[model samples]
Target: GPRSESGALDAQPWSAAAVAEATSAGRPVLVNLTADWCVTCKINERAALSSPRVAQAVKQANAVYLVGDWTRRDDAITRELQAHGRSGVPLYLVYRPGRAEPDILPQLLTEGVVIDALKP
Candidate 1:
């Protein structure tokens, strides 16, 4: 289990296989696509994703957290961005159990927003 700089939770590196496995097992997944130079990403990490309430919510939901760092050129991350119709970093997606599509969160986040998204 890997934690982000904000120490929000144990976030594993993003991988399609891992995400698929979690989804197939009826587990919630939170995917964070960010870059080192992205200010908004940093803000979200510190303001919302790192909140203790958010961490508790994630744990209570038994969710899997995955982070995709776009600090460099990564084909997999590029593909994901393209698939999601984006060309930049700071993408937040929450996949719930049995859901085919994930909930795309806003660029600016708050503790309440993250907590609400984690709700069933």
Candidate 2:
């Protein structure tokens, strides 16, 4: 995954094991599953994830930000999408520490919604 120039998130490369490790260590994780050609994904990135409030909320929560790029049909990303019952791009998931499941965000994002999702 490529890092964004915006200072809001330190986007890391996505991997199943990395997610497991972060959650196991009691850290909240935010996974943004997006693609180069996904209009919705681009919209969310600009309208919500890039918002100062939402960015600050994520930073304040000490969340691990991971971005999975499905622009090239990666198998791991495909498996993850299927596991989440999704077959397309622009999926958002928040994995809270000690939680068995992640909170799924809508394809259309808002600062308030993203801030709420990052809440401990």
Candidate 3:
């Protein structure tokens, strides 16, 4: 089971093993790449994170929410962002655990948009 609050999906961290588990279970994963001081990221958290629809989807899917912290400038993550062609925080990716590809979400998030995406 996922150890998180009903609406605190973004507040949690993800391990590679957890992501693998979700994929192995045929579930989707939600990856939120953000720093501590990104305004857009905070808004996304407030808007989408608190939405009941999103919370329900997360609870039901047991989605692996990967939050990569870039506040301190980690070289590994820097390489990842560069590889992805992204140079900023608040990057979101929804991937199927075992799947190599991820359906990436933009930095801006709306409740309806997230809910629609989470529907299976």
* TM-score (all chains, Cα) for each model: 0.93, 0.93, 0.79
Q: Which 10-residue window of candidate 2 scores lowest in summed lDDT?
A: 1-10
lDDT of 3 at 67: 68
Once superposed on the true structure, which residue ranges of model 2 sit more than 4 Å away at CA? 5-7
> Model 2: per-residue lDDT, tens digit, 12-39?
8788888899999988888888888999
Please provide, for model 3 over 1-120, each residue's C-alpha lDDT reduced to its tens digit, 9 standing for 90 to 100.
223422556545655566677788888888777666888877887788667778778777767566667778777667667767898777777877566877777678997777666666
Q: After superposition, how far is residue 91 of candidate 2 from its true place, in Å?
A: 0.6
Ranking by lDDT: 1, 2, 3
Model 1: lDDT to the true structure:
0.86
Distance from true position, residue 90, model 1, in Å?
0.4
Candidate 1 lDDT tens digits, 21-106: 99899889988899889999998888888888889999998999899889995889999888889988888889987878889888
Error of 2 at 114 (Å): 0.8
Number of clashes recorded per candidate: 0, 0, 1
Q: Which one wins on lDDT?
A: 1
lDDT at residue 49 of model 2 (Cα atoms): 83
